[model samples]
Target: MTNSTLAQLLDPAITPRLVVKVGSALLVGKDGEPRREWLTALVAELAAARARGQDVIVVSSGAIALGARRLGLAKGGRGSLADAQAAAAVGQIALAGLWAELLAGHGLTAAQVLLTLDDLEERRRWLNVTATLGTLLARGAVPVINENDTVATEEIRFGDNDRLAARVGQAAGASAVLLLSDIDGLYDRDPRLPGATRIPVVRRVTPEIRAMATGGSSSGLGSGGMTSKLQAAEIAGLAGMALAIIDGQPVAPVGEALASGRGTLFMARPRKGARKAWLGGKLRVRGSVHVDEGAAAALARGSSLLAAGVTRVEGSFVRGDAVSVVGPGGDVLGRGLCEYDAGECARLIGRHSREHEEILGYAPRSALVHRDQLVLI
Candidate 1:
């Protein structure tokens, strides 16, 4: 793999859609309040990036830490889920207020977006999120996103903002993702060790690279460790977005990281279209639709999967859930977001588009899977 620098990635010629992840360690002070001066500097950097025609989205983590301090909860311990949820409910207001005030100073409006795991997991929900964020960006508003801790259960929680930031970058089709943390970059071993060395760039996240993560958090206020950051990098790579992990303790950390090229940069692959990216990476297929050779050939020729082409439907899946499209001999052709649920699809198989309304009593869509939603293997 070739080594790369942040300076090369942040070229002025390339105006990027940037997703910035700020951890609680850099956002909250010892007194449980926002670190106003540091945040102000960061806002200045963001404003400069905007001036250069870059669109910025921030994924911030500080609500739970600030709330814990407000509620007199002891530090460095995973408290009860109820208490954590309660703290998030209170702390979110403070977090939003601080961000709004900071961005407003530069004449930029900040919009709060609280999301749960389901928001990214469900196809319909994911589309809604992408549209909302797109509209906000077009209107020159900065979207401050965070997990909805208030309603999120352990089963649905993202656990850390690093992975959430990666998902946000993927969903938003961002060109780059910046992870600001206490440590500057990834190291071959813990930096405290005598012979440890920093890895400047990563082209691919192999098993050896994952093994380098020691899962150590630098601050008590943040939940993510190096392991989580590596996981985030892998996600970003798959989404075709470059990711950088840099030290956030300094004033104008984003600017400094770009200027000095002192961060671990994970190179992204060639980007896929939005539908293809989501279909290939983020989805969990709930069912399979097997089609005959004619249907498979049509799909290969970039045609939509029609009800007339489907031979059988397997497993239970709801409308808009991702489902596998398989060939007659069980070879997986691709995946797509289905227009009809399993029951509807089963009844419509081998029927013509003109017969859909008569067979199902209502024809919401003619194709079982549209070409726009299909991603070939």
Candidate 2:
């Protein structure tokens, strides 16, 4: 990005569509209850965004913390992962209820969208999940998302909502992702050190800046720390979205960031559109196909997935499904919707598109996947 254009990123006139991930640590009080005022303040800022006609989604954590208090397990950590899952089971109700009530206070409705990583990694499910979030925002509803912890097995990951919030930002095509945490901003060292300083802005994510990060807990009852917040910033930045790790202690911190830009900002990397970003990055595949160097170069130059260059098909997939396209050396070039079934794909292998009917009785389309339907990895 042009160095002269940094100020434009901070302009409120841009009226960003945003995703705010509220850390569990920010919502807990000294007494360890959910801080009503802090939540209310966060809600008010989100409401302000809504008032300005910008969309907002809350990828919130705090269900276990809240449930621990309610279930009389506040001081206990002896439970197995299943035990914590059960605690989250109980806490999720309160989590949604409290968020819903707070939104209702602002005359807005909170629609809960609970998901597992399966929802994000599976191609069919990913599209549906984005559709759900999109519809909620379009209809003027604030979708408060949470991991379906009750059914999730991989609790240690994405449970922090750092990556989830990043995915949500990418999905929503958010202009910025605000990670509300206890710490005000990024520090050069642990905040406890005498000479440790707060870094107000991050122009680039250098390894030294990354080395400064250390682990922090979530609400004293959940997982996530300063390290995860920085990780979230990296994720958001990759999706062409700035990330603000602002103080979640003050009720008005969100407003403060809005008014004066008082937070650590990790600028976006000038991303492609949301769908392309999602398609290009992830979705674990059953197998892959290897292409020639010419195909690889063309793909690197932004060409779409096609038939002729595919030297081998690795997995069985139906037509119109997501598949990985790789170089013969085993580097993935991109992913795209397949035009032919795996059976047809094998027959059409290394053949030009115009040779379709001669080899196969019929063809779905001339192109294996249209440019718009393909995303370079």
Candidate 3:
């Protein structure tokens, strides 16, 4: 967490695109039901980002807090899992309504998008989520996203929205992810303990740095603590998105951190524009495409996923994204972005790339997917 040399200067006031994650602890006041007026200030800051021609997506947590407070459920962390689930169901409605109202005040509409691990774990669904968010950002709409707690099983949880925000930023190709927490930022040690120091920046997450991390919040507002923040940083870094941990309690700390690098900043991955990085660092893979040895060789030799070498297309996938290429015997040989839909891929089985125009009546380009978009697995 404390590699100051690796830290780069940032100004949220000028950063063009960012994913802002507000933890449940930060949004829930003592009275619960979502600290209404506090959200207004956050919205104002977001509006400022929008005015700067930046795309901002918010991954927020507060449903459980609202639900627990509204239904008079216990907040002592002694509640059963069922009780927490019920609280999330009640809190979701309140959280969505509050976000809609607050975002509306700035004349910007807010759209609610809820997902679980499946949304990121399934390749087809993952790309679908990606394209949808990209289109939303293009239209200048702010997306208020959260986990589908009512339906998400415990096994598939991301632990917290910190990681979710990091994934969203990567999927949307966001420039940065701002993790808002109670702490000002990562420190050399747990600041609550004596002799601990506030660490303003981090270049990389060395093991020694991780050793200094603390878990969750003693104040009951935080669950993932600094540990979760580190996890989120790892996710964002893999996607080549800048990561920042900053104070969420302040009115505009997110903006301040973005604009001035006032918090701990994690560098993005080493290489940019390298699709292989994305493929190797993938969160999950749903299905695969089977190719013959010749096709595999062609891919390794910098050729595309031509129809001829494709022995069989496994699993269902939409066009314009990445997929795994298996050998004739089911060995995954490579992964590449596809040009044609799975249905069409099935139709073109074993045909020549030139046959595309003859069969489909219109060619959508030569290879089913280009080599440039493919990565050898």
Candidate 4:
């Protein structure tokens, strides 16, 4: 699509947030050196977007590549997981510094954020991640995110930055994710073969589309290929966030390819409040909070669940666990992220908000469940 089409799809007045993913090949060379000029151009695009009153989050991969080189480990990160982690430890500093330096040039502050699979999967940590990212954006800072490779176990690793970027986009409630890749866009067939043609836009990912995506990066620097990009598109689409793949190999300014209609845009599903959809779809209720009739009525009116409204707390769940709110007649009013642990809820049940400090020995946030975190059944 052309820049006008792209702008209409991601109008700042509507879809104000965008997530950009930079692959290892785009940010780091095979010689293990940072591609300063390329990244400098990319950051300029990000700054321009921010100037247009849009939020930009970057999911970047290159630490492991740079770190592997610094540790003199095998090429292509062909080493033990421990060796890879060590390399990540060394390279993450430089990677973070590069982004900070470049963004600083545009008078934009860069916040380094490292995440793992569990951080996004677990409800509490997910809230923290969302809150942090939201705060950074509100304060006009760009978040440069990467996987926590240094400490993330193999079992918890995202495997590629593409999926990581999608998850970040979902968590941040971004309008779209831009995957900067070596290829211009998804092709009907392998581009190396004759008669291959680029697919300009994808409204959905079908089995036929899956057949076209190939795996394994030729550059050997990236863990993700077209297959992973397709996977990312599905993930982002489900979360109501569009995904675009554009070639970042060009020396021209970043976003030039997309502006010139040289990329694939995978459209998102109609958004129904991204966070609430996630909370409603994925959260497993760990406990129950039985509330009085008044509380249930208040919840129906879209007010937060206050301490006085809670009749009893059931199940052994800590603060931040998803809990079903039950009415006096055993009807489930809704479910939400519990603000207090089961033990704390038990102590505060039927008490006034003013008495919470005396009862709990410390002041805690009011409301057993905040309205923003609650979703009606």
Clash number for each model? 0, 1, 6, 0
lDDT of 1: 0.85
lDDT pick, better of 2 and 3 = 3
Ranking by lDDT: 1, 4, 3, 2
lDDT of 4 by residue, 1-377 (tens): 22324554346775689999999988998888899888888888888888888899999999998888888889646477888898899999999999999999999999999998888878688889989999998999999999999998877888899988988988888988888898988999888999999998888787789889889776778899999999788778767778888888987435577468788889887665666646543324789999998999999999999999888888999888889899998866677899999999999999999999988898879688999988775
lDDT of 2: 0.74
TM-score of each: 0.76, 0.72, 0.70, 0.72
Evaluate model 4: give its TM-score: 0.72
Better of 2 and 4 by lDDT: 4
Find the number of clashing residue pairs for candidate 4: 0
lDDT of 3 by residue, 1-377 (tens): 12342122134343567888988877888777577667888889888778767788999998888888888888622276777778889888999889888888889888889988878765677788889998898887899999887777677777678878887877787878888888778888878789878776666666667887888665585467788788778667666677887777777665655555557777776544534545544544545778888887787788888888877777778886557788876656656678888888888989987677888888557688787777654
Displacement of residue 289 (Cα, Å) in model 3 is 23
User: Hey, what RMSD does candidate 4 come out at?
Assistant: 9.3
Q: Each candidate: RMSD to true structure?
A: 6.1, 5.5, 8.4, 9.3
Clashing pairs in 3: 11-258, 11-259, 11-260, 12-258, 12-259, 216-225
Residue 110's lDDT in candidate 2 = 96
Candidate 4, superposed: residue stretches over 4 Å from native: 1-4, 7-10, 273-377
Q: How much does candidate 3 score in TM-score? A: 0.70
Candidate order (TM-score): 1, 4, 2, 3
Candidate 2: stretches off by over 4 Å = 1-13, 30-32, 74-78, 155-157, 258-261, 279-377
lDDT of each: 0.85, 0.74, 0.75, 0.84
- What tens digits encode model 1's per-residue C-alpha lDDT throughout 1-377? 12366864454355378898999989998778889899999999888877778899999999887787777876522478888887888888999999999999999999999999889887789899999999999999999999999999987878899989989988887888899999999999888899989899889777788888878786878889999898788768767888899999999998887777788999886677876777755535799999999999999999999989999999999898889999998877888899999999999999999998988897559589999988765
Residue 159's lDDT in candidate 1: 85
